[model samples]
Target chain A: MAIKVHGIALSTCTGRVLLCLLEKGLEYEIVPLDLANSAHKKQPYLSLNPFGQIPAFEDGDVQIFESRAITKYLSRKYKDTGIDLLGSSSLTETTIVDTWMEVESHQYNVPMQKIIRQMIVNPAYGIASDEKIIEEELEKLGKVLDVYEERLSKCKYLAGDFYSLADLHHVPYLVYFMRTLKSSVITSRPHVNAWWKDISSRPASVKLAESMRI
Target chain B: MAIKVHGIALSTCTGRVLLCLLEKGLEYEIVPLDLANSAHKKQPYLSLNPFGQIPAFEDGDVQIFESRAITKYLSRKYKDTGIDLLGSSSLTETTIVDTWMEVESHQYNVPMQKIIRQMIVNPAYGIASDEKIIEEELEKLGKVLDVYEERLSKCKYLAGDFYSLADLHHVPYLVYFMRTLKSSVITSRPHVNAWWKDISSRPASVKLAESMRI
Candidate 1:
């Protein structure tokens, strides 16, 4: 049976998972949950994911949620496909994957949420945008970008020499962020931008991006 | 060479790593970075963990920061000890682990920070507590606890069957929360309270809590 992914195509997280699927050259069905129709909050869907979030996944009898986790699971389950996504099962490489995953979730995700809230969510809710606050957030974000730049200079990917899901997870948010801000922050950080460019230009990423209409 | 963990005992995050180490029956040196003494911000330490966060771990030449990541690394690195701390390599189990981790990080950690700010941090800075606002935050937190109660009714641990790092990540926060909150919100939720009791009774948890003076 084909894998089924329950998520909106346009969602950055869903897009992240979609990119992973495409990268692994796996076929999956997109059971898009209409967020506009309040489908996510309704019954059945809530039973699948109590938190009422996406993107959720179902493969035959198995079901899972959380984009990063879903991607990691898929990577491990189908280990021999397009890329060695999790790296070798050695202690060092595994630690590297573990470390960067935490960095992405804890350090990067928090600041990115702040940026999203200020730039998109707040204004969409008819709330006023404070340029002073936005600029402050941007500055802090710039500092984080600096860290990425330094790290990328040393290695091709966030975790190490391998292009694991660690790099894949960042793709969607970076795309959304770049789309919304259209700023020179990434451009200024040459190594960071270069590494991003390398990943963003992948055939899998391109196919997923196009499918999601990003 | 022995493993060296740099963090203060009283810190909740630091306690998480200790709990994992204790659970695995690993012997390690604890190099306490005195938060009161401004040691975390000093040279060498800051260089190791760019975020300047506590609970940094050094095993031989491999150094990793972030408490959750460190715990995960320990669990995976020492899997031969027969402790099934990590979620299954399967897609579904990975999703469960990821979801609970998100719950621990985004939901639990956020409200706990709010409670700490209003009850401890603000008061430490001589800021007055707003009783009305605290009550509002309590209602928000109560709902989160309700979700936990619903989940614990089915599973022995947060992430399905096994006691993964998801439960361990939440243990410290529960320590602080139970101590500071005078209300019956937590105790009112029977399942949540039962889950807490089970976790608190664990030998590793007991040892970590005692070591941290929690």
Candidate 2:
């Protein structure tokens, strides 16, 4: 059976896994759930992901949730078939990739998601945007981008010269940041701007962006 | 030369990497930065971790920051020594471990750290504790623990029957959670309490906990 993904295409985390699958040239089925009706919190879906989160994945008898974990699993399982996402040729290279991936999880994602929630998601739900919170998040994000600016000046990608999962992981949030919020936080830094343009222009990323319709 | 870690011994993140080193029985030296003196945010250290986070690690020519990333590098580099932290012998097992690790990062860490800051860290720095924030964080943490309780009731550890990085990652934060805050969230759930007891009682965890002097 082909691999299956249970998630909405518009979801950021779901888009992350889909982009990885696209990059790996893998065919999979997306089993969409009616998240509007809380389908994810119901019985059958909870069986797939006990946390009731979007983007549960399945391949043969193996099942997984957490989009980054799914992407890592796919990268390892199909290491020979596609681009080397892990970049694990050496211990140092692998450590570089892993380090940036954690930075994304712990640092970048927090402020970015907060910005998205405040500036985009809240407005969509008829809730007023908290300008103060957005300003704080923007400041935090700007500091994070300053570090990225410095890193990209030294290397072509977050991990290194190669485009690994670390770069791919930023695409979804950047798309939302650019299209929905139209933030200058990314474009203000020369190296970060160049890196963003480079990664977001990838054919696989373009495909996911088109699918997201944000 | 032994591996050198550039971080304070008392930091949760630094302790995280130290615990991993202990678990693997690796010899390492702590380069101990004075965070109270703003040493991490200044030059030299910023070059090692541009984000200026604690727990930058060095071995031979390779330098890495981010505690989880450091632990992962060690696990893969020393896979044959001590325990199999990744347990990636099979696809299913690896995915399980990775999924829970993401849970720790995305779900568990957020509120746990928030509560720690509000209830413990603030008072140590002579800042007033935010009771409202602590209550809100505790509610969020309680819900997360409910899921953990459900999972631990089914398996011996977060990932599976064997201990993995997923379980190991929780030790430092839980130590703070128990020692500094003395929160009843974990102890209130029987299975979660049992899981904590089982993992925290490991020889490596015990050694690190003692070193932390919580």
Q: Quick one: best lDDT, which candidate?
A: 2
lDDT of 2 by residue, B103-132 (tens): 999999998888888766787788998889
Q: Backbone clashes per model, in order?
A: 0, 0
Candidate 2: list runs displaced more than 4 Å: B180-182
All candidates: TM-score: 0.91, 0.97
Evaluate residue A199 in candidate 2 and report its C-alpha lDDT on the 0 to 100 scale.
92
Interface RMSD of each: 1.9, 1.0
User: What TM value does model 2 have?
Assistant: 0.97
Residue range A1-214, candidate 2, lDDT tens digits:
8999999888899999999999999999999999889999998999888889999999988888999999999999999977999887987788889889999999999999999898777887899999999999999989999999989999999999999988888888888788755467888899999998899999999999999774
lDDT tens digits by residue: candidate 1, A1-214: 8899898877777888899999999999999787888898878998877777888888887777767777877887889988888765687887788788778887787777777677766777789877777777788778777778888889999888889888888887777676665458787799988987898899988776676542
- Indicate the docking level reached by candidate 1: medium
Residue B57, model 1: lDDT of: 89
- Per-prediction TM-score, chain A only? 0.91, 0.97
